[model samples]
Target: MLLVVNIGNSNIRFGVFEGDECVNSWVMNTKPYKTEDELYSQFKIAFKNYDIDINRIKDIAVGSVVPHLTYPVRKSLQRLHNIKTTLVSKNTPTELTFMSPQMGTDLYANAYYAFKKYEGTKIVVDFGTALTLTCVDKNGEIKGVVIAPGVITSLKSLIGSTAQLSDIEMRTPKQTLGKDTEECMQSGVIFGFLSMVEGLIDRINKELKEETYVIATGGTGHIFAPLTSKIKIYDRLHTIKGLRELYITQKKEGLQ
Candidate 1:
């Protein structure tokens, strides 16, 4: 069994993979101040509840965008299971070549998995705490990336900053013209982002002068993916799957 952990700014996800199949998964809030012991305890409870034996986990792969939580997570797994984790980073050996060394490991995983699974040029749009678009060419080289405020992030900011506005459930608005305040906010937030994404995809296609497969991932991918025909695929677990692939590659190359 392989355990893959993705620590993002908003959430930390754990995926248990048996060979190529992911058997189970879990998510927890990202608390940067959490100690190793606290993380170990959380892991123990989650594993027990899922009936997954800690001893059966052969290897662990971690990709963390949150710097403060990375060491604690790695140390927790080490202390709990006595297994050293393979942390995916920009330096990690993979078939994909990164354009910049500062790109997040999570983005690398997204691009690597997309490059391996799809043909031609691919653009990965991840809608997590931040909205990121990573472009990978057919030659397995990352071209560049675009980062913007995520759906929830933007919504929260708007609600937080405004004195008269309050939080509302995010959903697709029925029409471009909003009838009420909530609907107005929804239209501005959801449809606004939807247009932004579609426009970006179109712009990217124009810039490349070729077809590109756009894969959407992350927390709110499902919401926006179905609304837009531009998104070719939507897989929330894309990053963890990529982490699993990286782990396999590292093991094969004797790096792990």
Candidate 2:
């Protein structure tokens, strides 16, 4: 069994993969100040709840965007299972070439898997703490990326800044023209982002002069993916799957 962990700004995702199949997955809130012991306890509880044996985990792969939590997570895994984790980074051996050496490991993992699974021009739209679109071409070269405020990130900022506005459930509004305050916020945030995604894909397609495969992933992907035909695929486990694939590739190359 391979344990894959993706630590993002908002959440930390864990996947237990048996060969190419992911048997189980879990998500937890990201608390940067948590100690190694606390993290170990959390992992233990999650594994227990899922009936997964800690001893069965053969290897661990981690892709972390939050620098502060990386060491503690690695330490927790090491202490609990006596296993060293392979951290995914730009330096990790993969088929995709990154345009920026300093790009986030999570993004690199996303692109690595996308490049392997899909053909021709591909864009991975990840709606995490920060909304990101990573473009990779048929030749396995990363073209570029587009970054914007995430759906929930934007909503939180708006509520925090405004005097009267409060949080509302994120869903597609019944109409583009909102009838009430909650609907208004939902309309603006959800529909607004929907347009942004579509417009950007259109612009990117214009630049590429070819059809592009867009894969959506992350927490808010489910909310927006169903509302648009532009988004072809929505797999919440994309990042973790990528990390698992990266681990397999590294192990094959004797790098792990």
Candidate 3:
């Protein structure tokens, strides 16, 4: 079995995969001050909770945007088990020739998974901490990318700094023109983000000069995908699935 972990800006999502199937999954809040022992303790507890044998995890593949947690995660996994642990990056198994040097590993994983998981020209829009839109051809090369403020980030930016507004549920309000403050905020966030998605997809298609298969992911993607016809696929596990693929690819390439 393979233990795949993707560390995002807000959450740390981990999955236990039996071959290609993800049998168990869990999410942990990303805390910068965590020690390696504390990190490994959670893994042991999760295995116990899910009835997943700790001995079954033969490989640990990680895709992390949090730099501070990277070493801790790897070290903790190493300390807990003698299995191989890897950091999936463009410089590793996944190829991102066109991506900028500063591009996050999670984006590369999403692109690599989309390239192999689907056929023909594909564009993946990951609605994580940042709304990342990536285009990759059939051969697994990135064509372009667009990064924008994410749903929660935008909300926090609007409310976190301002004193007038409070947090609102991520749901489409009864009407676009809301009658109250909460309703108005919900409408603005849900509908406004939808507009951004549609506009981006349109521009991406125009730039590519061809229609591409669209995939939207992340925990919040479900709220937006149904509202817009632009997203043809919605699989939240895209990154971890790609992580598993990258693990196999790295072994196949004989990377030590």
Candidate 4:
């Protein structure tokens, strides 16, 4: 079985894939200072509950945004289980040409695999630490990207900037016109972010001739997808799925 790990800003998500199917998955908070044993123990307990044998995990591939934990994760996997690890790099097997090849590793994997699965004009809006808009042109080239404050980031910033704005629970608001402070915050965050997402999709669609398939991902995408148009949420596992594809392709090509 292949282990696909996507280390993001907020969490580190892992997926155990047997062929194209993801049999099991888990996620933990992204803590840079956390020890390897702590992370591995957490993963062990999580996977053990699902009846996944940690010893059975042989090959592992990683796509990480948090650079601080790079070596530590690699070491943890190797030390804990003797699993062979591989990092998804720029030279990694992929069909799409990167726009800014060195900007971010996770974004590169997302765009590459998005191009591979869904052809033609597409946009991958990853709702992570930041809401990143990655555009893949009709010819399957990484055209450009737009990075905006993520839903949570924006919400946190709004609360931080304004003393009157109280912390509100993140959920669907009953109505657009909020009746109370909590509802008002929820409306602004959920509905307001929805409008921003739809607006971006609409504008992108207007500029292009081919119909663009917008794939929404990250921890909060599932919540936002229901309230928006032209946005499809494939859960947060898509990132790890993308990494797995690249790893399998590279293996087939005989590239380390």
Each model's lDDT comes to 0.90, 0.90, 0.84, 0.80
Each prediction's TM-score versus the true structure: 0.96, 0.97, 0.95, 0.92
Which has the better TM-score: candidate 2, or candidate 3? 2
Q: Tell me the tens digit of each residue's lDDT in model 1 across 1-256.
A: 8899999999999999987889899889885568888999988898899999999998889989888899999999988889999887667798787758789989999999998899999999999999999999999999889999999999999989999999998788899899999999999988899899999999999998987999999998998999988999999899999888877788788885
Regions more than 4 Å wrong, model 1: none
Off by over 4 Å in 2: none
lDDT value, residue 99 of candidate 4: 55
Give candidate 4 misplaced runs (Cα > 4 Å): none
Question: Who is ahead in lDDT, 2 or 4?
Answer: 2
Per-residue CA lDDT of model 2 for 1-256, tens digit only, reads 8899998898999999887889899899995568888999998898899999999998899889889899999999888889999887767887787668778888888898898888888999999989999999988899999999998999999999999999998878889998889999999999999999999999999999987999999999999899889999999999898888787788788885
lDDT of 3 by residue, 1-256 (tens): 8899898888899888987899888888885568888989987787788898888788888888888888888888887777768777766755545657877788788888898889888888888889889889887778888899999889999998888999988888988999999999999998998898889889888987888899998878988888877889899888888777777788788874
Task: Name the 10 consecutive residues with the lowest summed lDDT in model 3.
Answer: 90-99
| Pairwise TM-score winner, candidates 2 and 4 | 2
Residue pairs clashing, model 1: none
RMSD of candidate 3 to true structure, Å: 1.5
CA lDDT for candidate 2: 0.90
- Candidate 3: misplaced stretches above 4 Å? 94-96
Q: Candidate 3: which pairs clash?
A: none
